[model samples]
Target: MYEKELEAILPRCFEMYDFMAEHVEQLQHLEAMPELKLRMAFQSGILSFEHGLSSLKLIADGFTSSGFALMRPQYESLLCGFWLMYADTEAWFNKLSTAGKVSPDEIKKLETPLIGVMLKDLEKSNAPAHILRQLNDFRGINNSAFNSFTHSGLAALVSNGVGYEPKVIYDSLRNCNAVAAINMQMLSILTGYEEAMEPVRKMHHHFVDCLPIIHG
Candidate 1:
């Protein structure tokens, strides 16, 4: 059954993996002025990739855990939480990606519900209804693992000249990475592919590697 699902998802996963991989590599090339500046510039790309990976992990976990009888008890709720986390993280990344692309005023202007677009795409692709609900639930939860970080939060504020620090963004990006790694390990197990997590991991590393160009 799991293999069957993998067979269905493999094509989409591979495609998304490649798409993300390219961006990650491109992100690595973006470099800033000083060492700290360079690190800061790369941080958002890292966070976006990690958060995306976490989303993929949740989907994988939920699908995998749904198959068993006894394991279902523990894994079901875990899977649910991960699913919500995935949606929330992706929303965060999409928000940052959009915000990062524009001026401070533009960031403010772009603050509508864009994640709804992504959710629609997911629904059109036949993503589970429950997963969609999970995402919606996550949207309500303000207690994010990544967003609460001082550096990341401050950078968000500072970017808009809101008198916030930049260091918060740096810390938040790391927090995103930590969650991604942990989440993907479980996904790898569920998908029965140690390489399941490879694409995203490599994507993050690739982005980090290209920090030089992205900063410019």
Candidate 2:
């Protein structure tokens, strides 16, 4: 049922793969951030790029649910990465110390602020105003669908157990790339270096074809 769609979309998918690969290559030599906590958060957010790219590949192969499944889990980490940076860095570590060291199970028990609250704190932290504002507005609009995708909710469960439409997958890939572009910009912010940041500032302008239509 999906062969023709795959034929049409596969080339675009490969182009995105190459773009992300180039990004991975581009980010390879970044020096660690001065503080360990900030460095960890930065790395966690960086992870979203590869994760998003992988899900794009899965979607291109006609695995819609699997691709949808990955969207939120990693993206949440990206959000949390920001939270750790601005919202609750010391409190989190203090909690971690109660466990004598980092324990995965204990970490899970720790409370994370909701997305809205985190964004508020990020804004207060003086994160880039434009990015912070867009993140807030975008979450307001799409959080439900994103949450559904992560938790196997109705949106991830399509009718008749069939693959998603090719256009849907194509559009999904574009949106994912848009998020990746944001991720790139965030990474550049982390670097605090113009050389690492210059190209990222023009990512969308250069690669608009494979990215979603974004204004701002």
Local accuracy by lDDT, each model: 0.39, 0.68
Number of clashes recorded per candidate: 21, 0
**Candidate 2 Cα outliers beyond 4 Å, as residue runs:** 1-10, 101-106, 159-162
Error of 1 at 3 (Å): 12
lDDT of 1 by residue, 117-194 (tens): 545544555445653554444434323422423234543344435432223322322333333333333333333345
User: How many clashing residue pairs, candidate 1?
Assistant: 21
State the local distance difference test value for candidate 2: 0.68
TM-score, structure 1 vs. true? 0.25
Cα lDDT of model 2 by residue, 12-126, tens digit: 6577557656755666567447777777677867688768877877766667788867766556666777777666567767775677565777667566666777777787785
Q: After superposition, how far is residue 1 of candidate 1 from its true place, in Å?
A: 14
